[model samples]
Target: MNSRLPATPETLAEQAADWIVRLSADDPGERQQAEAGYRAWKQADPRHAAAAAHLESLLGRLDDIRSRGTQGPARQAIHSARPRRPPPRLATALALAAALLLPGWIALQSAPADILFADLQTGSGEWIARTLADGSQLSLNSNSAVDLEFDAKTRTVDLLRGEILVDVARDSSRPFVVSTAHGNIRALGTRFLVSRQDDATVLSMIESRVEVRIDGQEQAVVVEAGQSLRFGPGSENSLAAIDGEMLETAWQQHQLVVRDRPLAAVLDQLARHRPGLIRYDRSAIAKLHVSAVLPLNDTDRSLQLLANNFPELRIRTLTPYLVIVDHEKNR
Candidate 1:
């Protein structure tokens, strides 16, 4: 018996899988109805991103069930699961500046560092990318920041918060390195992504191999093309295999793909990409799972799109600092 959830597989696929389950109802007519409404809502405005994200999340989880043949396991069982908490104030700040303030970015720009080939950051509803001096690429996840120091000795970056994807151009002398709150990630002629989750560090290897040494104890994770792992501060790591096509790397092409992730996890991603925070009463909807591929540029439109698709969900704008998600919308 899978004790993690209360719903049966059929129940999950039918009525109770999520805040967007109605989009997959018994009647084909009803399914198309929901989808049509969702499409129109997505087209209505730019900020409808939160809505699209939620729907995408639902569809992604459904696909996972189709492929993996099970409902969502506990988030903790997965190697990439993270705790749900208030958006870091820093992330919220970044969210506001990166999207709406891009025209102002040139004002903040300084001479590019020699070793630090590129530096990119985004605010809510914003995304940014940069070409490294070495012909590599660095894509900054929403609400992410990096202070880079790179040279022949090593490629070093400080992840103040959020996540960064580093695509390394092969170089033997200039080894690529990333430092996060948890530990240091060193690449052996590799490409990888590093993220900060609270005090822990999540590492995903997209190519070759990388080594994570914590407190001088070297551990070779040797992530393959689609493997992911999370090493908490002073703890062992949980390994998970990933499909790169569904990751934020896809965001480079104006896409956001998700997998069998919890509602809280999806909400955090929204918070990172948009101004303000999209929070839920976790006590009210903790068991739901989400997956999606909404555009990364507009979160408000996404939220509107989500509300239209899941008529059962009630979204209340409490204030600029917070938005609440109700499991069912008021009729």
Candidate 2:
């Protein structure tokens, strides 16, 4: 395949798809680096203008995918799979895009004033932990998200999505806190991994004690070492005591650890650590149970292992963005 960007509405989609595959390459430069290639192509031939224009149009829609309201799959799909190239008169297109998508592009001209407790993420096969100037440690578990907020009052972070293992730094004057969409966790000098589940946020405390407040509940539970708790969504409060570090917080090492969990949950966890989405018929394996410690960086190997154990499972990697398990291989 030439992997050239397409100009027409129908073929533009195909070009976008190709850009995603190349940008998602393990290399870090990605979009910025890919620009040089496209520019070179543009100089190579006049026809490249259409491809470049298509790509620029795609890039202009960047924030639509991240907007608070009215953002959905289409926006997310495009942003997550953003292409890298110099579209036709891209600078002008980008300016026009800013005007169209925002109240005023000038308002967002400057980066946000402050960034507190940032959770910098790396792609597949890259694992790195960072200790912020503030007394806190953030370990990004490949393809993770850590939302940060810091002010004179307190240093706080929200794991809006994905997984993070944190080692709490000591500072009595200010308590370190991490909150998710489902609940808020107040750490009292503790280390733990917090994962956002479909219906609850799972918190596994590795050291010291941590208090978790669910929704609007006044009563909070203290998770001790070797204990885990789940706070339900849209509910007052919920709690549980689970093994400390056994099958939990295991992604710290870039591995997916599952022990007899529902297959659906296990697959969801895998999808988070890797790039592509995993899809299976809800009816076929809804109740299936899974157990194993698999590597998060390699989707193909992970699927191969799954297919090996469950010969009845039919697994296919449709593209860089989608994986589909249609039916049992044996069937």
Candidate 3:
């Protein structure tokens, strides 16, 4: 049976950071509301309260460090020993800046190095389509990257990260293949979509068929048109039916057509189009369902539509690079 567990420690720490950011807002009304919301969140679970306290203690230590660094003896000793130290107020400002920006900074830095050097790469919120020398069409999703290797024997696409839609040109002599960390998807016919996730590679066959071969596996699984499969190194998911039109809309029309899917799934797609970090409490929004045809190119408008549709959800764009989504109950 499926069951939900308490929020993980990592999630709790993120929530604590969210509270700190919210409570530090400049507007008095916003700060007051954030404080009330934080109190309720802290009271919801002992873990939540402890996490908040621990973060507060860390901030306190930063203040202590700033004080000590600027004191008479330390300041004089440092000045005598070397060049002048930064002003106390400047040091305090820098400390505050680091505390405010560290979470987003860490998240930004977490992107894979392979993406930077990929033969073809798209930035956040950018999408590109290209026709290869073989006359095959390829489209990359936002924040996606791939390295292409074309030779006399084979046409290969190394999907370093994110998703790609390929319309393969018929080449009897050469086979078209998409490779991920877990497996290789060899196109049997015309079109297909391959997405690389943390754990598995998702194959959505659009026009024809594809053969998925997991690493170290002898046999290959055939996915026909209108079918989807998720496979990793060790296991293969049962083939499931997919909406071909929906997959086409994603690449051709640049829109997300959702039907009774989890809110987290929608947010995952939005995160690709959005720059910076999209942070949320998974446990809070896990049960919420979303059904909408949202524009992929305009994520801000899509987010606004979501907010209008779900009053229970509070979506805040904390910074250009940081978005926070949380449930009203948590507040």
Candidate 4:
């Protein structure tokens, strides 16, 4: 039996390192506020304080290495120095903190700035279902984040990343709206889905109707039940009829149903349920088509299934968090 827990960024040690990184900000006001919050967080629990202490010690050792000049004696001394290895926990924390020090590394390793601090977020391969204060049912897909802003006039869900399904409760006075970077979707009926894609927003009408308005566009389009719409800046708007049963199976049973979809598109959806990076050559597998029902919760099994279905495809694990998929011919 493997007793070791996976070293995820959501651990206590990583939270302490996150605070340390926040405190390193150049803004004086931000640093001051962060310091206050850090103090409270450290004092709130003994584990937090211990984690912080471990991270600080790790940083101190790194600072010592940096202090040694890169030329002559310093470089030689650095090569000769044999520092004691930190415990497994401290080593993992240090690795995560070191990545954060690099520019844009946090965004690459975790999520965007807005999504990182979202009110509700799900990590890779994780899903969550919640009932809002207004009794509306909300379900978030893997690697998703959303912020809620409810007021007297409107009940808004700001989707920062990934996809969300909402079963809106009827409120005659207040309208239910789902907002993405590309546009806003107003729920005209009840159940619907809104997804924030790489360069577009997709709306999947499950039960009722939705009014979609793209950014900078005055005219709004109405999407009926069993229909899907894709809109963005450069891309032309596309509306297509969808099977309600397949859509329902996705959210209800955590299954992804596809029919003759491009391998790239299917991989993109699968990547959301997977942690780390999934690297593949776009041109290599451009002609490959996929038609299957994949299990969202078990991404490892799903990858195996893909590998089994496509004998010409090669899937290799470069690391625990990094995967490489390529056509056999590419090699």
Candidate 5:
């Protein structure tokens, strides 16, 4: 059996980093193995390709740094002596931010350096669908993960990161519950979507009903179809009625249907499907609103559509991994 386990994005990124170091070696055998391993990994997951592409871009920048020939004595010593050394965190961070296209991301601080665990995750521009053993279905958006445990008493899935769409199968003996670091969502024979934001979790119901319980809370707030709730670590709960049909189910079809959503918000959503950063002059265009059906499958095309709609909007690409949007005069 292939002992190679399913690669999470973090592990894959590390492997990509290692391969970057190894591929630079002059030894033919090592270079061949590194190349082979990289090809296999890239074939294993679409996300791996994004990781590899990013490493390649970073390597180009390193070459640029070397070509500049402007190194201090200390830096030169480190570079000449440590030929096989891994790239610095700053370089990796820069490359990763570019690869993820973080809009207006300044540096490593904006990178998700702390997130370490994800049982299942998608790449920057990938989506996946899985059928659980119990016949329930789950689909993960790009850059998302979930830890699942199914047993006699419960079928629990911890949304370690990102967003998930769950279609729960009815099993009276085992209650299906989905959780994030912020709170838990008990699915009551429902089809629903759960997204983990920086400081809050957003839950939207598509069918049937579900109960929301914040961590360490007793009273469960029931959310039915056509309803959405945003909760944080504390007991602060904000619930609203929404048309889940357009916003919730549209992603399954690779579409985002929004009504008068701000440009920043739309870019944020679009960033999930792309690798690297999609940065804009937020201060200048934060209030610019858009209403359209943006395609999730081809994000670059979607960006083009957005630009075409707004004559004042200008899109600039520093590298394939870095995109900037701003007014033409600000270019």
Candidate 6:
């Protein structure tokens, strides 16, 4: 059953599948370990490479079928099993994947400029609120970074990484603009939230309106109050109406509002405010829905809240920075 004894194509494919699932883990340490283990297993035998290649080809075929925009049993099953949420548009689906995908974290860690060029930055499990020279209030989430560039003509804020809530001051002469890897958000005397994801920028208009321009696009998309949009390379998704709860800006209040969301998604959001990593069972937790207000300032309490509500869920801490959550099995 072990990888060392693998000789058949079927066994190699199973091992490859395990590696693929592990590589999708949200924890950085787990992902690195999984990748290292995968490499070692692949090198153990030449046939392993061929079997892995075959599995990859099969996945590619599945992707191609998906790209054609055809609906089948696989698509229906995927959609039905997922938690209730907004429909994922092309690039939008992969944009926020940094929370669940290993490659996204890898890309973020490799970006030296995100730190080297940042004018203001906050470490993991830290929060900061500051007022700019123009009197605009800015609140950064954990592990967030931004660069301020204000001049006579324009007020530009380059979001290096993470999320920020901006309460913009009226400046007709100097338009307040926030830029990210995917696009630019120009506030028109308003308050808004901007979060930089793995492959896109998520903009939420809280007050008045903001014009969004995807990178390399001349035309801008206007998002009014109670609306949010996600745009990425070569694709701009449509706007979705925000709920009255205003979940996007809840971070400013040090609270995470969950309205019947999957446990897996909740853990993903919680990982943002905490240091190190949070590992959990995606399939098992996805079946369980959560609806509660968790405190952002104290992640441990937030976790306790989850455990309290879901008695079957077990939360374990191997270290101060590493946590594993899973469902309790019947003996």
Q: Which residue pairs come into collision in candidate 4? A: none
Task: Name every residue pair that clashes in candidate 3.
Answer: none
The local distance difference test score of model 2 is 0.60
Task: Rank all candidate structures by their TM-score, best first, as comma-separated numbers.
Answer: 3, 4, 5, 6, 2, 1
Residue 43 CA displacement from its true place in model 6, Å: 24
lDDT per residue as tens, model 5, 1-331? 1226456555455456554544444456766685688678788877678657655554444443333434322233334555575456433333344334323233334545434445677877788999998788999988787888988899998897778899999998889999898888987488998988777898988889998888767888899999888888653587788888877658768787767877887898888787676766677786689999988888888999999999999775544665667676554
Those runs of model 6 whose alpha carbons end farther than 4 Å from true positions after fitting are 1-111, 216-218, 233-236, 243-249, 260-262, 281-291, 309-312, 327-331
User: Which segments of candidate 3 are over 4 A away from where they belong?
Assistant: 1-110, 233-236
Writing each residue's lDDT as its tens digit, candidate 6 over 178-266 gives 99988888875888888887677888777899888887778889999988897996544788887623665476578877667778878
Ranking 2 against 4 by lDDT, winner: 4
User: Which portions of model 5 miss their true places by more than 4 Å?
Assistant: 1-117, 216-218, 233-236, 328-331
Better candidate by TM-score, 4 or 6: 4
Point out where model 2 deviates above 4 Å: 1-126, 234-249, 319-321, 329-331
* Backbone steric clashes in candidate 2, count: 4
RMSD of each: 19.3, 12.4, 10.6, 13.3, 13.6, 15.4
Question: How high is the CA lDDT of each candidate model?
Answer: 0.57, 0.60, 0.74, 0.74, 0.71, 0.70
Q: Candidate 2's error at 187, in angstroms?
A: 1.2
What is the C-alpha lDDT profile of model 3 across 199-266, one tens digit per residue? Answer: 78888888888888888779899889999888885445778898986778767878877778788878
lDDT, model 1: 0.57
Model 4 weakest lDDT span, ten residues long: 69-78
Minimal lDDT window, size 10, model 1? 10-19
Clashes of 3: 0
Question: What TM-score goes with each of the models?
Answer: 0.56, 0.60, 0.69, 0.68, 0.64, 0.60
Where does candidate 6 clash, by residue pair? none
